[model samples]
Target: MNQDLIQTFIEETEENLQVVEESLLDLEQAPADQELIDLVFRAMHSIKGGAGLVGFEEIGELAHYLENILEEIRQAANPKLPDDIFNLLFAGIDLIRQMIEDNDLTAKSVGRELTELKKAIKHYQLVTQEGSSDEQTIQQQTGQKYYKINLKFRETIFETGTDPLMLVLELEEVGTILASYLNREQVDDLFHLNPHLLLMNWTIFLESEQSLDKIEDIFIFVKEDNQIVIEEISEELEQWFSGGEETEKLLRKEEFISNVDLDQVLAKQEQIGESLFLQSKTTKEETGQADKQVRNLHKQKRTETIRVATDKLEGILNDIAELLIAQSRVKELATGIVGLDRSLQSEIVNSFQEVDKLIRRVQEEVMSASMIPIGDTFTRLKRMVRDIAAEKEKDVKLVISGEDTELDRKIIEQLADPLKHLVRNAVDHGVERPEQREKLGKPPTGTIELDAYHQEGSIIIEIVDDGRGIDKEAVLAKAKEKGMIEQESQLDDSEIYNLLFKPGFSTAQEVTDISGRGVGLDVVMSNIKDIRGNVEVFSEKNQGTKIKIKLPLTLAIIDGMIVRVGGERVVIPLNSIVEFIDASKQQIKQVEGKGLIVSIREQYIPCMALNELLQLEGSFNNLKEEPTGVLIILKDDQKQIAVQIDEVIGQEQVVIKNVKENMGQAEGIAGATILGDGNVALILDVPTLFKLAKRLKVG
Candidate 1:
C-alpha cells in the first residue's frame, strides 16, 4: 500500500519485463537454449512475485499464467514453440505493459484483451497436455521425488519488504507438501517481541516431479541470506515405508511418527547432517573469502553509478553555464585593470586558465551522466519490426549494430518516434514480400539493419534495408501529380530522393494501413529538424534504401565558430564548416542562372553574403565591397554552400539556450548562446541556411 513500495515495484517490474521481451526474441531463434528459457522464466517469475507484493492481482494472475506456459515449454522434449504461442506470449507482454501503465487495480481498460489472452493460454495448456499425456504419465511414474527443505530466514527479512511466506507459497506451487513443521524456537516472548521481525522457520517435506535444480530455483530469491538446506528423502522414505506394517499405518494416519525408533534411518539422517555440516563449513570458508571480494566489487559499482533526476541534472548544467559566463566576465575585467603588478596579472591569468580547464572537465562529466546507450531503443525497434513483419506477412529480419553507442538521454527519448516511423516505412514500403524477393533471385527473408555510430562530432543513425529500393521515377511522378514540383524541373538522383520528405508526399500505388497515407516521411523530417538534426535518403533501384540521420551528441553545449556577420556575432557549428576562403583569392562571378558563384579550384559553389541573406545593418551589403570580408564554406551530406562574412572570430565552446519559447521559431537560427561579454549570439542551422540560399536564387 506504500507509494514508495509501489513505485519500486513498478520500476523493477518494468526492467524484468524488458528482460522477458528480449529473451523471448532470442528464444524464438534458438528455442533449445536452456539458458534463454531460464532467463525468460526467471524474469516472468520475478514480475509475478512483485505484482503480488504490490497488490496488483490482475498483473500477478497474467504473469502467473504466462509463467506456467514457460514452465511447460521448459519441460517439453521439443523446446521449439509454435508461432501462435510466441505471438500469445508477446501479446501477454503487451497487455501486462498496458496494465502497468494504466495502473488501474480494477483492470477496466484491458478487461476484454485480458480475458481473451487467458482463454488462449488455457487452450494452449489443454492442447499441449493432451499431446504430451503419455510423456506426463511416464514422468509421473518414474520421476517422483521427495525433498526435505529446511528454511531459516534472516530475522530482518521483513524490513526488506519481502514476506517469507511468499517463498513458501512459491514452493507450494512447484510441489505438494507431504508434511511441514513450524520451528518457533527463535520466537521471543510475545510481550517483548518486535512484531515486524520474522522469527519462524519452516521444515517441509515435499513430493514433486520436478528436477532438483528447479526446486532449488524456488528458493533463489531468498537463499542468499537464509539458511536453506534441501536433501533427497525419496529413497529413505520408500525404504522405511516398505520395512513394516507399522510404518504403512503411520503414513495412513497422516501424522508425524515422533515416538517411532527407526535407528538406522535416524543414524543416517544424523550422519548425513554431520557430513553436510563439515562440507558446508569448508565451503563457507571459501565463500567467505569470495563474498568479501564480491562485496568490494559491488561497493565500487554502487559508488560508480547513482540515479539522479533529469531536472536536477539540468539544474547542475544550468548553474555550471552561469559559472562559465561569470568566469569569462572576471577574466575580461582582469585584463582591463591598469597599473596592476605583472606577476599578479600573470598569476591571475593562469588561475583563470586552470578554472577553465576544471569547469570544462566537470561539464563533460555531467553531460556523460546524462547519456544512455541506444540499445534499449533498438530492442523496442526489434519488437516493432517483428510485429509489423508478421502483420504484413513479409519475411523480414532486423539486424542491429552499434547499439551500445551512447546518446544524450533527452535526444534519445525524442528520437524514438522518428526512428519508429522510418523503420516502419522501411518494412512497409522498402522491403518486398517473401515471394517477390524469391522471384527476384534474392533471399526470401529480407534484412533491415539499424546502425548507429559517432561520425565527426555528431551521432549518425542509419537504417538500411536490402529490399526493392526507392523508385525514383515513381517518386518524381508522384511529386508532379501532387503539384509538389514543376513538371519540367531538371533534377538529379539526390534531388529526386529529397522529394520523399515533401509534406503530403507518397509514391505508393495504393493506400494501406502501414503507410501510403502521405504522412510519414514528412513527419520524420519535421521531427528530426526540430532537434537541430537532418535526415537524408540514399537509394539505388532494386538495391534498397538507406536513411541516415545526423544529430548532435548533446543539445546543451557545443563547440562553435564565432564569426562577425554585419553588426551581429553569429555562432556556426564547427563541425559544419568545411573551410574559410579569402574573397580576393577566388574568382567571384555572377553567372546568369546561378546568381553569385565562387570558384574554388575547379568547382563553383553558390555564394551568399550573410549580411545580405539576414538583412543585417551596419556592414556592406555585398562581399566584394568589403575588402576584409571572408567566405566560410559549409557542407551537409547533400550539398555545400559558401557564406560571406566580415571576419572570423576565435572558436569557443558555448552553452546552448533555447530561445524558441520566447522568440518563436526563427528561420536559419537553431538556438542562441550567451557570449563572454554578455551578448547573445544566434547559432545557425546549416541545412536550413543552405535551403535559404537556394530559395534566395529563386526569388
Candidate 2:
C-alpha cells in the first residue's frame, strides 16, 4: 500500500471505530432504533472496507464479523440486543482499536482476539434465532404469515440489465411461494415485442417468518427500476378475491397496473421512512432531519483536510515567537534615537505600530491553526468513565458541554492524562453506589459534567460531579497524619481543599487501582502548572465537588502591563488587571491576624505589598507605614487582590519565554518576557500571586 494511503486508512479507521463505540453505547439505551443500528453497521462496514484496502486482513475480518451481527439486527423485524451483546461488541471494538494502535499485521498478533470475537458472533447468531422463535411463540405459534409480493418491472428494466426471474429465485430463499402470477396484459404480440424490454410482472404469495426488510433486500437491486409492493395477507388472502384484503405492489414509486382493478387494496407499501419513524420513537420529520444532519456531517468529514506533523507546527510557532521578539526590539530602537526629527520619530513610531499590529495578526492566525477541538479527548474520557464506573459497580453518567471549545494542540495533549485522572477519581471515589445514592435522596445515576470554556484570556476546564463531595475534615486529618500540615493550624475551606494537591496527601483509607495513593491529583496539579496553569478545588460535603483548572490561552505571547516592584521589573497579563488605585492609611485598616484589608468601592479587598509577596527590596514594605503610590487591582476570575506597586510603566505585547525550562518554576511567576528596553521581565501568574498574598497576610 502507498504510505500516504495507509496513513489515511489508519486515521479514518480509528475515527470510524470511535463512532462505532459511541453508537454502541447509544444503542444500549434504544436497542430497537433503526437509525442507531444503521449507524453501527455503517461504521463497522466502513472500517472493514478501509482495513481490507490496507491489507489489514485480521482487522477486516474482525470488523466484518461485528458488522454481520449488526446486519442481522437491521434485517430483523425486531432485534433484542441484550446487555451481553453490547458488551461483546464493545470488546470487539477495543480489540480493533488495539490492533490499529499497534498497526499489527501478523496473524499471530490478531489470532486470539479474532477467535474470541468469532465465538461471540456465533453466540449472537444463536441469540437472534432464539429471539425470532420467541416472537413466533408469542404470536400463538402459528406456522407463518403470507405476504403478497407483486413486482412490475418497467419496460426498460431489461435495458438496465435486470432479470426478473432472478428476483423470484432470491425471494424463494426467504419463504415458500405458493403461487406467482405473471401479469402481461400490456405485453404486445411476439411479432411486435421488444426483446430488449421487460414486459412481465410478478404477483407472488410468499409465506414465511422472515421480516419485510429481508423480503425487500431481494429486490433492492431493482427497487428503483420496478414497481414492487408487499402487503400482509396472512388471513386476508382468501378474502382478497372477496374484497377483504388490501393488495399493494412490491415496489410503489409509480402506478404500474392499469387494467387489473383492485379497489380494495391500498395504493402503496409502507415506506422505509415511515417504518423508521415508528421504530425510532421520533417524528418522521425529525428522523429525516437527523439523517440529513448525519449526511452533512459526513460530507464535512469527507471535505479535504490534511494532517500536518506537530513538529512543523511547533517550528512555525517558534518562528512567530522570534518575530515577536524582533518586533519588540525594533520598537525599542524606534524610540531610542535622540535629537531625531520630530516627523521622522513620529513616522518611525507609526511604522513600528503597523508592524506590531501585523505581527499580532500573524501570531493569532498561527495559533488558530494549531488549535483543535477538545471533543475527541472528551470522548476518550467518557469511555474511561463508563468502564471505571462499571468496574467499581457505580452508576455514572458523564455529561459533556463545550466540547467544541478549541485549545492549543500541545496543551490539549498534555491535558489528556490529567483529565483522565480527574474523571477516574470522580468515578471511583466520588460517586456513591446506586443504593447509597438512593438512600441519600439523590438520583441513582450519578452525573459528572465535563465543561470547557474561555475566560480571561485562558481556558477553564471544569469537572463537576454530583457525588459524595470532598470531606474537608478527612482531608485535614489526612494532611495532619501525613505530617503535611500543623495539627493546630486552622485552615479555611479553600485551604483544606487545596491540601488534596499536596504530594502524597490522600484521604482514602486504603489504596485501590483507581486512586487513593495521593499521586493523581498532585500530578494533575503539576501538569497544569507545567503549562502556566492553576487548579482550584471547590466542594461542599454531601453535595458535589467542582474542580476548575485555568490555563493560559497560548504559551507563546501575551499582552502585559509592565510594572516595577522596586528595582525588579515584572509583567502582569493585561487581562488580569481591573484598575489602579491610590490609597492612604485611612483606606487601609489592619484586621488583627488577617492583616490589611483595603476598602474600595464598599468592597473589602485584600492588600499585599508587591515587595513583601516576592520578598524583594522595595520602597514600600511595612504595612504600619502609610502606604503610597499606585495599587494595581488584579482580579483572576472571582479572586481579587490589590498589589501595592511603585508605578505602572505602560503596556506592551511581550513574547513569553518559558523560565522553568532553564531556571525552574519560580513562585508567583508564570514565565519571562523580553522588554522593549532589552531587559527580561517575569510575568506574574495572577492565581499564584493570590496564594502568595494570602500566605503573606497569614504570616
The top-ranked prediction according to TM-score is: 1
For 23-85, candidate 2 gives per-residue lDDT tens digits of 787787688776777777767867775676567788878887887677666644456766767
TM-score of 1: 0.83
Residues 1-699 of candidate 1 have per-residue lDDT tens digits of 899888888888888889999888988889877667777887898888888887889999999999888877765555557787788899999998887788865578889989999999998778766775543211232355677787888889987778878878877887887656565656689788999888776767777766665687777667667788887666566432333554445333432223243343344434433432211111111211222232123222224445477899888888888887787677667777623656577778688778879999999999988889999998888888888899999989999999999999888988999999999988998899999998889999999999999987889999999999988888888889888889998777867888988888887778988788888788787778778887778898788999889898998888899999878999999999999988766667777876788778888888878877766776564544443578898987647888888889888778788887887656688899888788999998887777677768811
TM-score of each: 0.83, 0.76
Report RMSD for candidate 1. 7.5
Instruction: For residue 614, give model 1's deviation from the true position in Å.
Output: 4.1
Indicate which candidate wins on lDDT: 1
